[model samples]
Target: MYSPRFIHCLVSITASIVAGTFLQSTTINSEGSFTNARQSQAQKVQVLSVEFPQQQVPIVRFPRDVYPEIKFSEITQPQIQVQANKHLTIITIPTSLLFECGKHHIAEKAEKALNQVSQAINNRYSGSWLQILGHTDSKGSSKDNLQLSEQRAVAVQQWLSKQHHLNVSMVTTQGYGETQPIVSNTRFDCFERAIARQKNRRIEIVIQKLDHQV
Candidate 1:
């Protein structure tokens, strides 16, 4: 039989060991929970706080000095010819740049340029009316030239209206064959005349600002 003092001492020692073990377990669990919470918070920050680059969402504009904006699209001699007026911006796209000689079909390379134009229109000129004008030189017969010019204008209009899903009603087209000659196709030499004809064959994209903003 154990003495009373000895039994009391054993009870105290057992109680103390149990208390220490419980305390140590509680501390370990608390530390683990804190670490897990920190990891979860960091993961949430990484997932939700994603930042996009400038190129992904860049701002595009049609800058006007209160004038019409005419942007030239070319690869080799790329240029922007902006005439700042209150009413119209005439963007002159050379036929030579858009098509092969004597053909109205827009070339594969011209698609990229047209896409850029479409994107710009979507960004800034959603409310404005766009008039595309096709012109030709005096090299062909008047009837043939008229048909060709109209076809070219219609092609561009189709791409803008259908391919880009732009406002078709806001877009219009007209063809002037050898009637409005900014440069004469009448040259004494055949080579000079060809060059003049190339110049005369051009498409003008006119951006018209309406009196009331839509």
Candidate 2:
């Protein structure tokens, strides 16, 4: 026996309480979903970071004229040849100019040529890679020739670093012996063979252009 107005009041109160409870539950669920989405995005970013790492140093080549300080005419000589391209600048010196027969010591006649080479490296080719490749004629045994060639290359490298105060780390030496010859070492004609042998015995100075400049 509740009055009509009282019953109506109770129903309205219950409805309001139910509506408030439902709204609060909806709000908590929405917050949880938003948090989950943010965590998922962060996890994705972490995965991407682990997938790709930093890179190493890159090797780069340059066109000729990159270092215009090296003069081709001044470095070139009667027995020495200078060749340049995008990859390397090769300076070929006859073995007779740098060394005596069966010896690795730098001769007195080689001072002028060596001075020019040192100047070029100091002037424009600083911090660049240098390779001194030694070659010989086909007169000695393969093992002996190889050792001699390596010795010659090392001698030149030492002279450059010691005399000119060039960076030693930037220089490397290798010996090809008689394996790479510019002319044929023939035995048929004595005079022709001697000429060919002279051409074959040489040292090649290779300078490579680098991306990193000091």
Candidate 3:
């Protein structure tokens, strides 16, 4: 029933309203996308800022004054004796006093006894050499055990060097491993005999008097 001119005017108004709504929606969508992009960039920057380099822990060495005491009853089964020669003073160190199972480094508890022994030697002899010997029970392979023994000896030597400020040349390390057995190798006696054989796994301090020829 409306005239042509009126209908044309109504259509124009409706089209303008729709175009305005669409423009508004497009503006809001663009703003939202920009905000999301900024947030993502911020998150990435924050992650990068928090990244840092990893640090390595240094090895710890104990002083010789803290060596633990070993009871005479512990080593009394066969009475392992330490021999002292003019150039060498062999000090028997029990496994019970020196190390725990599968550990090559010297414990902090054994430092005191080692210090005492070193002091005694220093008092009696001058310009002496110390050889740390590492021995193992005859249970594992010779090559593997020998390597472990050598590591143990080197660990003791490092401890002594750090504690006494001794020259590296004055100290030597050796690992005999299971090659030298002080007791018979048997299944029943293996553990007990290994404990007893701790005497052989000791540090021998060789005192070579400067006046004496090598």
After superposing all C-alphas onto the true structure, candidate 3 shows an RMSD in angstroms of 31.2
Each model's lDDT comes to 0.62, 0.69, 0.52
| Winner by TM-score | 2
Best by lDDT: 2
How high is each candidate's TM-score? Answer: 0.59, 0.63, 0.53
In angstroms, how far off is 120's CA in candidate 2?
2.0
List candidate 3 stretches off by more than 4 Å: 1-81, 187-203, 209-214
What is the per-residue lDDT of model 3 for residues 1-214, given as tens digits with 9 covering 90 to 100? Answer: 3335433432342122211111111112222344576754443221212324444222111112322222232234232334432223355555545567667878877766667655654555446555566777665677887787888888777876788666668767767676555554553475776565554444333333333522
lDDT of 1 by residue, 83-152 (tens): 4344455566777766777788887767766777777666656677676778888876998887888888
List candidate 1 segments past 4 Å from native.
1-84, 210-214
Per residue, candidate 2 scores C-alpha lDDT tens digits across 79-196 of 7666564445667789998999978888888898898878866776777778788888999897888788899999999999889987778778878788777778976499999999
Model 2 regions lying over 4 Å from their true place: 1-71, 211-214
Q: TM-score of the candidate numbered 1?
A: 0.59
As for model 1, its CA RMSD to the true structure in angstroms is 32.2
| Model 1: how far residue 192 lies from native, Å | 3.1
